[model samples]
Target: MSMTANTAMAASTPRRGSSIAWSDVLLNIYILIFFLYLFVPLLIMIGAAFNVNSTPSITDWQGFTLDWFTGEVDEETGRVIAKGLPQEDRFLQGLWHSVIIALGVVAIAIPLGLSGALVLTRLQSGSTTFLYTLLISPILTPGIVLGVTTMIFWRDIFSVEAGLFTTMIAHSTFIASYCMLMFMARLQRQDRGLEEAALDLGASNVMVFRRITLPFLRPTILTAAVIGFLQSMENYNTTFFAIGGSWTLVTEIGSRMRFGLTPVINAIGVIFIVITVVAAVAWVFFRKREKG
Candidate 1:
């Protein structure tokens, strides 16, 4: 009986191993498929940027060239044969506009968000729930409605035309909620004892906040600023209606898509990808170095 049981157990071991191996193989295939789905289009876009084709295409590769970055040069006359990213004045302007709007959104959103977070977190009131709901309502509101309402509000109330300012305002409306959430999360983790101790030691409320509260919230503020900037930069629907005659880099890209796509757009994507990768790498290294 012992001999028979030993043989049976040994036989079952191989079957278990085989099942485990098959599951691992299936998992690996799934991961491969997922990664391929995620990155294949990005790889195609990057490839298209180098292709000499006028239109953005990976399959119809004319030849590898840097004409997208630097305009096709007329060798004889030394003049531009075709417009490139550098020569695309409107796109460049739009990029500049995006940067400006992002900065403005960050500036506006961070302060408003901080204020809201402070009110909700510090004030012990029954109305806090209502106030919290009201403050966060903008985030739930549709971008189109926000854009249209913002445009109309400015035009009707202050006679301010929809432009970069309106676009910035529209972005800030919802972005502020994002910032507030970040601030609140940071605030929740804060040690209230320090503030209480400082106050007990005869420190003014302003001084306690400036020294303790502000220092604790610094990292969250930086994070919020970055998030706000990114949100403002990528915003489309709200910007489209609020911007009136103006345009940002994203909106300009959308407009171009309607007309026709170009390798310049791919070049832009590649540049952003490179920047994002570099930033991520730098952040990792910085964190490791700090830890070390």
Candidate 2:
């Protein structure tokens, strides 16, 4: 009887394995379809950047040209235009402005976010929930509403001018929440004993924080800084309101789009996409090396 029962179990195992294999195959096919759906638009955009013609339609394959990268001149007006390519000083200036603003936002947001996360983590009361909601409220708010509110609050109430500083502050308001949330999540899983051990080893509070807490938080800090920088750079709605006629890369792109779409924008997109892909690849390698 025992041998018969064992034989029956063995016989059923292959059927169960077959069912799981079929399910996995179907799931992999769905995932592949989903990835292709997401990737096709980006591939089309990158391909279109290399096309000689700037038409939105992707049916025709114009011979590859680099005119979109090399600057062009307006024949009738004799004015230098962003028509053929996007290498003008203005675009460079706009990119520089974005970089500066992103740096400023990171500088202000990181410390504030770290402190906020620390406070929220230490608190153990009902009010902590309210504070969490308050910190994250900006993320839920519409960008346009945030922009308008920022403009009114700064310009009318504080009598501040719209410029780089205002834009940085506006961006930091929401971005800090993202940083705080990332840190808070990391902190939740962190072991407190390491910090306590450092304190017990005759280390001063500042020394303990510098050597122990900061090192542990380095990954989170780097993640937050990168996230904040990217958010500030690509932000359009809040920056648009706070810029007060000041130009940044995103705004410049919007302005150029009003005249006509150009492949130059695609060139810029391609540059950024390449940078992002390279950075991600490097990060994966670095992580693997650390594990090894």
Candidate 3:
């Protein structure tokens, strides 16, 4: 019996397959290299922020210093020689302009998006595709085209110069499309019967919208605001052309990259990285806690 069992076990374990595919191994290596390529620049940039050198480079590393972020500190006098003042910084000035534009985008985009979504969703005709395409054409158009067209149109027609206002408008033209798409998605999931019942019960159209539609869309409104704000903040080409001589933080960064590169720019990048990581972590934590 022992001999028979041993023979059976040996027979069951006798399988020998071909070697692992070189293609799969090469694909995994390629994936690793691809990730490294993407991350290496960010790592180098982050590393330079901690170096004391004025130039943004990791190869010529100086001792660690925080002067770029917190201004210069007097070593002997103990009083800060350069108190980390954002107000005195050109980058900070551009950041303030970015914030102003972002706020303006949220204000304009939310309303336009809401209106567009309303029209698209409520339309009873089958020929609504043309209108939808027309409305969404701005999103498909290149940002540079939008910026140049807006700048020229305003200059020729409205006598408005290309500046912060024009940048805000250029951003809104596409951003509103994003908001409208989000709103349309939410509206599709909505039970229209509730709105109709409210209207039938003598509620004014505005009242029904205010009480029913707005409440249901509150979550979407917040999401659209966040998306629109981020889009506005990160915009470059549109803002560059439509902003005339003015600058936002992103455009300022571009100009610095073109004219003079410095560790201060890396410092700015570090701040952005920290803020993004913190926000993502906090969002996850809050969501988990809420679910629990």
Structural similarity to truth (TM-score) of each candidate: 0.87, 0.82, 0.84
Report how far residue 55 has shifted in candidate 3, in Å: 1.2
lDDT score for candidate 1 against the true structure: 0.93
Best of the candidates, TM-score: 1
Q: What are the candidates' C-alpha RMSDs?
A: 6.2, 5.4, 7.2
Whichever of 2 and 3 has more lDDT, that candidate is 3
lDDT of model 3, residue 254 = 92
lDDT of 2 by residue, 1-292 (tens): 9899999988987778777878989999999999999989888888888887777435687788767777566789877654554456668899999999999999999998999999999999999989999999989988877777877788888898888878988898999999999999999988999889988888899998898889989999998999899999999988888888789999988888898877788878778789989988998998899898
Instruction: Write one digit per residue (lDDT tens) for candidate 3, span 1-292.
Output: 9899999877865453334356658889999999999989999999998888778788998788887787886678877664343423678889999999999999999999999999999998986898899889989999999999999999999999999999999999999999999999999999999989998999999999899999999999998999899999999988989999999999998998998887778888998888888978987997899788
User: Which parts of model 1 have CA positions greater than 4 angstroms off?
Assistant: 1-21, 75-78, 283-292
Q: Is candidate 1 or candidate 2 better by TM-score?
A: 1
The segments of candidate 2 whose C-alpha lies over 4 angstroms from its true place after superposition are 1-13, 16-30, 72-86, 283-292
- Candidate 3 lDDT (Cα, 0 to 1): 0.89
lDDT, residue 176, candidate 1: 99
Cand. 2 TM to true fold: 0.82
CA lDDT, every prediction? Answer: 0.93, 0.87, 0.89
Error (Å) of candidate 2 at residue 280 is 3.2
